[model samples]
Target: MSDYSSAFTHCETGNLYSLKSLIDHVDAQRLGEIKDKHRASLLHYAARHGQTDILQYLIEHKKMDANLKSENGATAAHDASVCDRLEALEYLFHQTELKSNVRDERGDSPLHLAAWYGSYPSLKFMLEDQRADAHIRSYDGSFPLHYASSHGHSECVKLLLKVAPDTVNGQTIAGLTPLYLACHMNHLEVIKILISRGANIRLKDEDGLNCLHAACRNATTEVVGWLLEKQNANVNDCDYSNYTPLHYAASSQHESLITYLLNRGARIQAASNGNTPLHVAAEYGRNGSCALLIEAGCSPLDQNVQHLKPSDLAQQNGFTDLSNELKLRERSLIHKALPGSNITSVTSVNDSVTQHPKTSVVRLVVRKKNVKRADVSLQVSENEIVNEIRQQSSTPSVENDTNRRRTRPFAQELQAKVLEHEANSRREPNNSDINQNFNSSHDSSQLLHSLNSINQRNQAGKTRAKLPHDVYGPWMKNLDPDTFKEQLNTVHAGLRKVRRNSLVQQEKYNSDDVHVSSAENEYTLVDTSNSENNDNTPVIEESIRGKEFLNNQNKLTSKTESFQSKSGQNTINSGPKHNQFTGDKTNITMPQWQKELIERKKGIKA
Candidate 1:
């Protein structure tokens, strides 16, 4: 048997003598059975490595098949074209009957492989001498120009475009033209050749991404500049998702490309889903891109459809430091936009504010026409704004008061006031007087009077009823003594049961050392003091106590009648005791239950 591995190695390395010796010992049937791991015959290796003498020996002496295919369906000619072996390819085409346009398993022809690998010699030879079809489409519907342009082979691309000129703008199955591929791969030379040969630069892919959009993926700034300046590609052209090249550059974190795009008039505020390029940079955690965009005047305050600002999105995506920096930038911008604050330069505001063991006073000089020059020193920390600071002047004027009020942090207070004013302005005409009078030129005192009147009307409307005393009065007056005593006994028994439960719970809590949270204690108090209790626990207890007092009053009236029927002398002797009893009873004129219930109601309201 022939050593097929050794024979294949000798053929590949141009060891013609060893390959001939191995092949001469084997018969034609055994030579036919000699194959490598990829099922490639000896002729495939000899032709692939430009071993012309080994090729003649394998074909003429051993009668090896020149058209044998490997597992990938690559023949000797396909292998020769892949490695750019012009001699091996010519020998295979001329000496044998191997065709030049044979395809591989992927349907890539010899010309396609030659152009794909930038094999200029083999590619020219295949086009000029062998007459290989340069317009052959691969399984992916890609022509030779597509491969040459994509791989950055300018010469190969020129040859293919010259031979098949109509294929310059020819698209693949994915709608990718030769120019799109060249720009996407950052092939400057190939892009020039394709463009000079009338290749369409504006063709988009199936994803609606144009050449400019694709160039921003890998971010070739030169190619992007050429596409914008020379080719006049639209910088603000949106893809299917409305993503411009700036959005792609931001996503890739290409700072230079982003800056170049911005200089080329790319819209900084171009949004998709209400998210601008700044939001996209923050979302992908591109800190440099985010800073560049913000410095280019892209507002970090621009919100998405979900109403999330760039800082909010950054925080949601776990970029805490970036989110905080964005917040600082937003504050700086807001401070700059505040009107009439005389903030000439706030660039050092963030830097000047620092942490100190003792509070640092920031002296701010206010300059206004015909107003007293007051130097207000405010104590502020990092990112903390003082909302209000009272200014005590030796001679307090109205202008000083106004200027002092304006010296407070205008960003937070004025922004909230502006938003509230806008909301009030948008209210319907039938809204309350506050909303209706918001834009009116009414004086402060008039507005105060209107507010006071409205409050008085509301308080009058919400006046509590008089506890239904009249309805219970007639019923209490008609109550007999026996029924009143039964109700009083029932109320005492209920109070005893409640007291016992409270004591038991207190003892259980003490013994178990169970510490109730403030919220739980509050909930228990609310539950016991609920006014809507169907059992009317507190109401029944108060009613029974009041009924007992009424019964005592009736007994006192009967005692007075008995005293009238007695002698004047006995009445005079008991006058002092009677006067003391009456004085004590006068202190309890209002029922104890009603007074206690009114105090409890006041405590609950408090």
Candidate 2:
């Protein structure tokens, strides 16, 4: 018995060539020289491997088994036919005598497996050799044409039909003709070839689907168009899926296909499962397809089987703009006039600088029109708009100008104030003072410290610190909570009512807690007062005779009540033996009559 695993390993590893040579080199004779694939002969390996040189050598130089069937029941010709190896296949086909029928494991002849792997060259070679089987069906009743058609092999389909046109409309195991599978698999070329070979385009399978209908339902746009226009297939055909070609195109979100099909006589209003093209688009949020459908004059007002319109479907899909736009098409204006309220006239006085990476911010700076005010000034970047504003204004002074500019005390004060603000912002504030000048044209500097610093920076290193992320001062956690609480206080008065109501609800709960505490305190207070009264007012009165009498009475009453309760409970628990000790062996013994009776009873039993 041969070791199958070892032999298979040898065959795959090409070790068989070497190991067999060694075995024969020992004068192992013809037995060792002759070799085969574990499950197949040399010709089978030759055909499958496509080694034309080796196969030629094997045939011409070394005469071995040609029609030898291995353990798999596969002939060399079958392997040659299954794999598309033209030269080896040709050699094998020529070597064997012409045979129209030879079945493999699947009961498929070499021709059927050739068709299955779409080995076009091999199939053609087999056909040319007149060795190809056309009418012979496999175990599943699938002829060569069926496999070729099912796989969308166009050239092979053409050749099969050319050799055996009678099998063009042949039905397979599923009762489906070759044309049906071709069209369903979107094999446009195969469909064309089959149609040219007199294949029926109207034949349906178990699904009541003709070629055209399946093509459309599967979003096989090219196939559908080919079937309908080229082959003049039926346009109005439907399937058991209850869907027309138009329903498929829209449902598949194939906008271009839908448009083409619709133009090519596919029904635009055609419905399936109660949804029109527009309804399907809206429900599924196929925005591009929906737009295309609407543009194609599909009405948004069309209803589904559920009686819901496309616009309603759009609203359900959160198509807010589309829904509103559709409604706006029918809208009429109600009012035209607009009203306005209090507006402040603001005139900036200083050359301010502001800079931001994403947007421009206005910074305020106040300076005397004539002299360089030392009042706190900041540096910022210039945006185009602020530059235009500066260009239209007077010449700006440098913040570093010391002697050429007379510094005012007011300017110093301004700079200090600005520094204080920036410092609070966690940004470093300049302690330098501004020139003092109330009469100078620099009164608005305080308001524009951040804004004025916007466009002009004497030093290019500073960046504008904005909003909450500003880093001027050290953060105080206590201040942060109070500030946020104050912010809540500044919330709109209407929300204040809600806040107050929430506070009141919380207060009610607190009030309940207070009531509980107060009740407990009151009870405690009463008990404490009674205890104090008992201690202070005394069990005995201050009168000498009354004190003595009252003390003796209280003691006597306390002892008498306790004794009575205990004695009553003991009597209640005891039966007739009230004074007898039940288990006190030191104090009592069993009754003499009972003991004697026990002894007499025991003696009789024993």
Candidate 3:
């Protein structure tokens, strides 16, 4: 047995006669019992080092178990495959009965090892001759396809998928499919092969991230383009947290990728946790990415869920230069748009910081302009004035109350002056004759629409003037009776037409023209309950049925309520509340024994 250890040296060096001589001296029963530090026998070493003759001698004459597993469950075939020993692998397959599918300690079969180690010759031999299971999953639930695809062995992946096409979409324990692993490793060729073989590109991993998301995170620009152009991937597709690939690209500081996605219509404002790609860039100190995003019109004042702007994020994360740059860009945009418009001079950030101690935190300074009411041109279009008013009125706060009150009297004075000017212009006989001479029905309609729009704008301003502390009430208190009557009639007619059209479309059953039934075209209400609505017919049917059921239930309840109201006038002093339908409410107050007897009697009524 002591001399048998010397046979391993001979076996390792491929000294056939020296190994044979040494093995012959040992006892025949003890010949196969040899192992090294890794618990691998001489046969394992022979297979690993491509000593085919030694393998033949040990397995044939010494009668060693060719399928004997090492401490890691690796058979001689696994060792041969891992070491790329083509001759030893073939000899083991043809001359011995070694199980090629035997798993090692990591649960990797010989085929898995062959694919992982890039043993092209050994892998082909095992797949072609040994008939290895290409779809066998390792302990981590990774198939041989995963191993081949992960290692960028395109030919090995093709061979595996050729034998087992189903493994192309096989997932690992982490729910990563072969395509995901290929994209994760940036193996474009492997990914292309997998896609051509029907790999699902849209498959998301356990993290709800797709291959494009992975590619962007790993900065694989070519893979990103392939997925976008070839696969028609949704550029704006969001993960579970509503994070687009642009967010990942920006956070990872992939500036070129961010530009590419933005050109392809990736939403620059798409956010997760209210943090845009710009916010993510600022938070992660991606200054270059921040510059690109800012140049693309991303607003610096947009706040996250925490109500912190991107500049605030940069400031909090110790990026003072970036925060200052963002503030400069914001101020530059504002000043460029409003040059010489009585706005405050856009002060340099350094000056502001030195002049005002409060500017240390980069507080937003909203300076009021000194433009007088007379500065507003009367030639401004009505729509422009209305839009300006809406912009001013939309944000209502207690701090702006005094400013709003001051502007209100100025607005009324301007309106009165405009009316006086219009009245004086109308008194001129030349202007009156010109208006009457050139006005067509179209011109008259246009003038009426403008007047109506002005009236509506006035009403909206009045509504917005309500104080927050004031109690809300009916807004139509000052409405004219005739005008209110006309509006009510118009609303009633519209509802009646809707009900009539709903009934006609359902009962007529004109399949050729479901929407337009040789009568009139109008907007139809859609039913939300009909999940399988292929066309307008099912929707119409479901909507009509739902409305009719509601109507009948309402009528029944109204009738019951009317009866209860009338009967309650006489029964105000009755013993108990009465049932609306049966007039029997005292049964609830019946004694327990009497109730049981009554129930038994009712049950015996056969």
Candidate 4:
């Protein structure tokens, strides 16, 4: 049995003498019993290896089953088509009763196998001579065209499309159209051929992703550029997760792709996890990408859903160097904005300038100074205060320049007064001198208080009003709770009133008696005679239908008259307006113009 099966392998290589000797040794009755583990007979091998003479000898002379199927339900014809055995296929079609359209377990016909393998000759023969079904869908709902396009078989694709152009947009079970598969496989030529044949570029797969998304996934620059530039694909197109091409490019760490998408206006801020392109770069430890994104104006302070900034994410992911660099960049930008605001830098005693980390930040420090209790407090003179006030008021009224210059002198005068008081206290340190200084200081203190009061009032008038209790400022111990409570209560009351009214209306409507008309179930019968036939039958007037019916009648008449004049017909064909209808049927002939208008209204409704 093993020798007989081995002889079939020889038959696949077109060795006729070995195949005949093995058959004779095995006896002709046992010849048909020769099969591999997959149950494929000698005919399957012969067709697969393009052994035309061996195939004919097995089927015609040895009486082999030409239509014998393999474990996958593939016939010798399918193998012949896949292996490009055109001569064997022709022999099978002409000499045997084999079915060409038989599908394997995958539901693919011989045509699909030929197209998948890019066997141009087999595919052409099957399509032109055998007339094999080109539109047969596989188990995955993929047509023969999908296989050819996805595998980059340009010739097979062109031939299949030429046979059946309508299958260009045929989708697989995964919702992958031929164009999308081509892009996924990076078959640039197949993509062009499919698109040229009217394949829909905007078709989204089951994942809600387009061809551009597939191209971006594979980082195929040519496919992506063609889709964007030639196909007019949306640069900012998103997937099911709202991820744009820039997100994919960033994740792939392709600098060129990232730059290409960014330059073409791919949004860098589109985030799936609240992380921008910059965050993705940092999370993946893509240092080059991080720098590129930062230079492209991606916000550094963008926080992910976890409230972690890009730098924090980098540090958490073990990219400490990148994290530190990002922190330094942020600090540098802040420092440049404000030259130096209450900040000072100090180097460590043991640290050298070259060895110092540029990431070190300058901090502000405040130290309290010890003050001596003088026997007398310093006071500004009344004449000096008055002179300073007069000079400030007499300063030029040009603008802020004059106001700034005028205020500078007052500050200088105050400094001078303090210095003079310190000198006097040092020069004379006697009890008698202390008493005299105390009295003079008392007079100066009063004048200084008056000048300071004047300055506060002037400054307050020119400054913008501050909030009552600013959160960004130092703690102020005074706040009125009653005023805040009053405003909050007013807003709450207004909201409550609106909500109550809505609830009340809802309750009223729910409790009210609602009437439903049964007009469709009843018929209106009118009597055309002046005399009543039956006393039991109540007479209903036309006015019961009210102003709406009258308006409609007037509109109909006017339209009919206008249409008549337009068609050069003076006579009116509106049959009759019956006052009462006696039967179930109301016969009123509407004009052509009326019918046309009604049709136009119907079309608008549809």
For model 3, how does the per-residue alpha-carbon lDDT over 383-444 read when each residue is reduced to its tens digit? 34445555565555776687667666755655665465456534423422433323332344
Estimate the TM-score of every prediction: 0.52, 0.40, 0.51, 0.51
Error of 2 at 562 (Å): 90
Deviation from native of the Cα of residue 414 in model 4, angstroms: 36
Candidate 3 lDDT (Cα, whole model)? 0.69
Q: In model 2, which runs have C-alpha deviations exceeding 4 angstroms? A: 1-16, 22-46, 52-78, 86-107, 128-130, 150-154, 185-187, 217-223, 251-253, 268-287, 290-606
Per-residue lDDT of 361 in model 4: 36
Which stretch of 10 consecutive residues in model 1 shows the poorest summed lDDT? 509-518
Query: How would you encode candidate 4's per-residue C-alpha lDDT over 327-413 as one tens digit per residue?
Result: 666556544444434334522223352233343333222222343322111223223444555566566458877777877687568
Pick out the ten consecutive residues of candidate 4 with the lowest summed lDDT: 509-518
Can you list the residue pairs that collide in candidate 4? Answer: 526-581
Q: Give model 1's clash tally.
A: 0
The C-alpha local distance difference test score for the whole of candidate 2 amounts to: 0.56
- Candidate 2, residue 398: lDDT: 66
- Candidate 2 structure quality by residue, lDDT tens digits, 284-354: 66677777776776655444545455655666667645545443321211010111212232212111211
Between prediction 1 and prediction 2, the one with superior lDDT is 1
RMSD per candidate (Å) reads 21.9, 30.3, 25.1, 33.0
In order, the Cα lDDT scores of the candidates are 0.69, 0.56, 0.69, 0.69
Model 1 misplacement above 4 A: 1-3, 27-41, 269-275, 282-285, 299-606
